[model samples]
Target chain A: MGAPFNYDVLDLTDEQVDAEVRVFGALTAAVRRLNEATLRTTVDHATVEEVRRQVEELTARLEKSMIPDNFGVSFTKGGRIRGYGNAVVGIRNPNAVPLTVVQDKVNGRASAEFELNALHEGPPGQVHGGVVALVLDQVFGEAAAAGGSPGMTGTLTLRYRLNTPLGPCSAEAWVDRRDGIKTIVKGELRRADGTVTVTAEGIFILPRWAREEIAKNGGTPPQFE
Target chain B: MGAPFNYDVLDLTDEQVDAEVRVFGALTAAVRRLNEATLRTTVDHATVEEVRRQVEELTARLEKSMIPDNFGVSFTKGGRIRGYGNAVVGIRNPNAVPLTVVQDKVNGRASAEFELNALHEGPPGQVHGGVVALVLDQVFGEAAAAGGSPGMTGTLTLRYRLNTPLGPCSAEAWVDRRDGIKTIVKGELRRADGTVTVTAEGIFILPRWAREEIAKNGGTPPQFE
Candidate 1:
């Protein structure tokens, strides 16, 4: 059987991919600003209403022509990924926490430095526990990939040790070990000054389809989360 | 000894609260539309840049005068809640999954009917696993609150039995049992057709601060996640 979904490995030039990254990246940043302003604004009702109308008009202009559905992860002939709809690190997703993970393939590690804001609050001024899990899941997946063995998250466990303040934060993860098809990942969420607030462990495994594909092609599958 | 955060019990009348809800809810919906368009649109680079400028201008209008930080959960004299910054079910939060959970206060049950679109995608057409955890965490927190034992999420575990497609979905959670200071909530994520795709159990606990407040003031803390 084939993989559960269709992923197109397209042929595109580096120049084209670079331009798309630049253009869409800027739009995503702008939308993120809009998201933050939407929460903190103390503007009056009339201003809010007027701004809503303007926002709708701009959205319509962009939506004139669009993809049929979500931006499925696509691979370029050059091996660049266009997983632009990812919730945690999608470049085009304004809902993301604006995380950019750096992979250390030699060390089987992944790390990110990001900021959380008013929109990410859970208990008063603290980051939402769910958001913390979301970011860690991504970092863990990247760590598994950095180790050259990747799969979907089968089980993720988190222990909340301390409250993470809503501001500058960092996350680091590394591949702990592997057992057959399963890769174990360990990681933590930290404050800017480097105090650990949460710790996590995740089990990642190749789904049946990926395993079957490997049996047939003897090729490793792309990293997925 | 204070509740770890300042919560103002305001004197806003019903009319004022209702109006704020209506106005802010509309803005949140509009921003959601913009978020989707940002990912799906196929407009040209010039058009994308133009839209970004327009979006930035409109956002500035909203940000002219704003709250210093997050919209912390507050209670009115009439008991209306102002938790507009919440990540899961916040009406004023565009990044929320747009969920409206129905609480069966009598039976310790809570459920929500919402939609997950392109922005929530992870594996091709399926919803992100972290997003699933995010939604279940909120519903489970609500279930604990409905049981008359509000608390924060101590730990959450999710097992992915199947992939949840991106579209209309439902979630239901109930208080499975309770121990001293802990509530165990069980729930599942289902397709619109009612097939369970993800099963979850969460442990909710009254934190030290909340416990101290309950001891001194002889009152239960509000539900937090």
Candidate 2:
């Protein structure tokens, strides 16, 4: 209602930006706490119900500041956040399905872990194969991003090593090499016992559009941390 | 119940194989008809509604053969007729998601088309990006499989060029090359106006498991054509 929408420019009020950052930090902390509980506790039916209620409350609060259009990530004065309101990787929402990315910089390797609850399961007792791909894609993309080149997904191939269990699980990805426009990254998912569940490798391309966007914004390209 | 359950393979008399074959043939023919109609028509609300009714009726008949477990594709008796029954490419049921793939062998190119009906859509109005990836992966994998190797998805990467229209759309995939264990394939989706919507590429691997499975089954891999 404030202004007509145009793709040319992204406008965010200072208050909106502050609110988004606060919400994102809260969400990150909440997910971490929930994940910790899931990993540490027995997590019976009652616990699951309690967790669900907490998630619902979080969802309600996040809905208030929801932007009508998909919001892109921004580096504010502080570099604490990225993609605050993006559809897949948005940080400022209860529904933002976040993936925890851990990097082994010395080894040039990286891994990620997340517990998908009822919100993520696709098959009856197994995680949806597509969901597995979604997580793998993000994890692998981030792994490549961490490897001095952040590229968009060009092609990803996954092998279903086994039917992934729907409960607590972990995933890992690491960089293979850089070949021209392609950044090859390898990734895998596993149960707590370390059974190789799904193995994947991806070729991410430095997209022309994203590069143009970076240039237009007067920003240097993102580099490996 | 005529035999406890309708399509229990254990209960199916030898004679029922012929009946099953006939029924399957009819279903295939019906799917072909639907495909033809889809190509010929604009597929407006009235058209979709009409088609939905027909789909419902056909689905009911197909559901009559409700086996206890999922019906995986099968071939026996010297491949007289391959059971595309459980193929994820058929149009009749929700399970296969009914992909329409067309290969231009003369040009060594292929394209696939399908609709994201009420069942498949995750986000509002826009087709789920993951669903788009699923169809692309299947078609791209099949394209690689067409080129002698018969590989599985080793990696797939997609760039969401645009929010794919919820209604009628098309997908295309082509074999790029083979490098050792990786068969490189490229693919895309487009709207009716021929605008390139989504672009994808995948590295398909000729997994050791599939090779062994083919050898155990004996003879050439079942011809996809």
> Best TM-score goes to which candidate?
1
Where's the lowest-lDDT run of ten residues in candidate 2 chain A?
Answer: A1-10
Write the residue-wise lDDT of candidate 2 on A1-225 in tens digits. Answer: 111111222355566567645544453434423322222232233433443344333333333343433332334443434443322344432233455567676655667667654334332234545567766766776788777667666666677765565567888888888899888888799986788988877777766765665577676655322
After the best TM-score superposition of candidate 2, give how far the Cα of residue A50 lies from its true spot, in angstroms. 21
lDDT of 1: 0.85
Q: Over the stretch A99-157, how does candidate 1's per-residue lDDT look in tens digits?
A: 89999999989999999988887776778888888888889888998988877778877
Q: Is the docking of candidate 1 incorrect, acceptable, medium or high quality?
A: medium
lDDT (tens digit, per residue) of candidate 1 on B1-225: 124466778999999999999998999899999999999999999999999999989989999999887777888999888888888878888888877888888999999989898888777777888888888878888889898888787887777777788889999999999998888999999999999988888888877855774567555476542
What docking grade applies to model 2? incorrect
lDDT of each: 0.85, 0.52
Tell how far residue B154 is off in model 2, in angstroms.
8.6
- Stretches off by above 4 angstroms in model 2 are A1-68, A87-89, A223-225, B1-187, B191-194, B197-225
| TM-score for chain B of each model, two decimals | 0.93, 0.66
Per residue, candidate 2 scores C-alpha lDDT tens digits across B17-122 of 5654444434333333232222222223343344344433333433343443323233444343232332235322213456767766654466776664432332
Name the candidate that leads on DockQ: 1
Poorest 10 consecutive residues of model 1 chain A by lDDT? A1-10
